[model samples]
Target: MRIESESAKNQWVTAAFECMLDGGLRNIRIEALARALGVTKGSFYHHFANRAELVRAAVERWELEGTDAIIALANREGAPAERLHRLLGVIAGSSAQQGRGELMLFLEASDEGVGDAVARVTGRRIAYVAQLLEEHGVPSGLAQRRAVMAVAEYHGARVIAAGTDSLPVDERVLDVGDAIRFLETTLLAP
Candidate 1:
């Protein structure tokens, strides 16, 4: 069963991504997503050749929105410190949605594409952080190390929050904010 319409295809991809975020890779079953979206399995087959292709599309959407778009937003004009501050602020604000990327990391052993996508996003994020650090006059090696540490702390917050969504959103955001502040004080201190 096949259908036509690029918008429909994108809809499937978006739904798939949302499903992934909601329940990880295992939640990306075609029938489940179709039922969730109120669409038929045929519609999914039309958009994606198979489950793996849909999963790839879903992960790609995650990369675009979660990684590429955020980096672009943080690249806007400002002093490096100001920009980094804004970046971290946005991250802390989005603590509720933080865990999907960390959850996706579990797929590294099972799905090569997911593993590669996660790796690329991680590297790109680390490089962006290191670039900002260098712009703030930190030496290259130190900047790289700090960027890695900073990213670790940020993603660690995500992983930790992933399991605690039952708590109030504010609490998770505050926890992430505290972690970010500690990272800043420890890494960005004079």
Candidate 2:
């Protein structure tokens, strides 16, 4: 569409993502988003063909935000370890609600309509991690293994952080960054 219209579309997609993060898929109603945006359902319809289309757009946006933008930043910096450190730091600062919302998105990705897009994003992550490891002088096979381990580490850390209430989840998240840093130093160091 027109440039101005595209901005509205982007705003709607961003609002849908926020809805997902705040309250899962159930919170992504047109009326709710319209109210949050100080607009009307007609505005949402103008941007999206239907609710499913909106959901797809939101997921696509989230995937790009989580992967592509971060990768671009890492590549631009030319310091793999430091880039990864910053990435993990961002992850560690995320709220428990965000972790839950991410888990929900992963589950929803299993649906037939969304599966390919999610899988593509995930595969891209693994490949990117493997490349990073390889650049550290790791053999290809080992790099691939370590890449998977890295992803597992992130997921495991989030799972652990989510399951505990004895300490604040944000406090637990600090351990995740520390744990990943340990892996970087001991296992992934060049």
- Top-scoring candidate (TM-score): 1
TM-scores for all predictions: 0.85, 0.83
lDDT of each: 0.74, 0.73
Q: What tens digits encode model 1's per-residue C-alpha lDDT throughout 98-174?
A: 36544654554265356777778889889999999899888899999999998887766566566654755446246
- Which regions of candidate 2 fall more than 4 Å away from where they truly are? 1-6, 164-177
Q: State the lDDT at 1 in candidate 2.
A: 20
Q: Write the per-residue lDDT of candidate 2 for residues 62-170, one digit (tens) a residue.
A: 7888778877766776566666666656655667778777666776666626777778877887888888778767889988888888777766666766665775556
Q: Give the least accurate 10-residue stretch of model 2, judged by summed lDDT.
A: 168-177
Q: Give the TM-score of candidate 2.
A: 0.83
Each model's number of backbone clashes?
0, 0
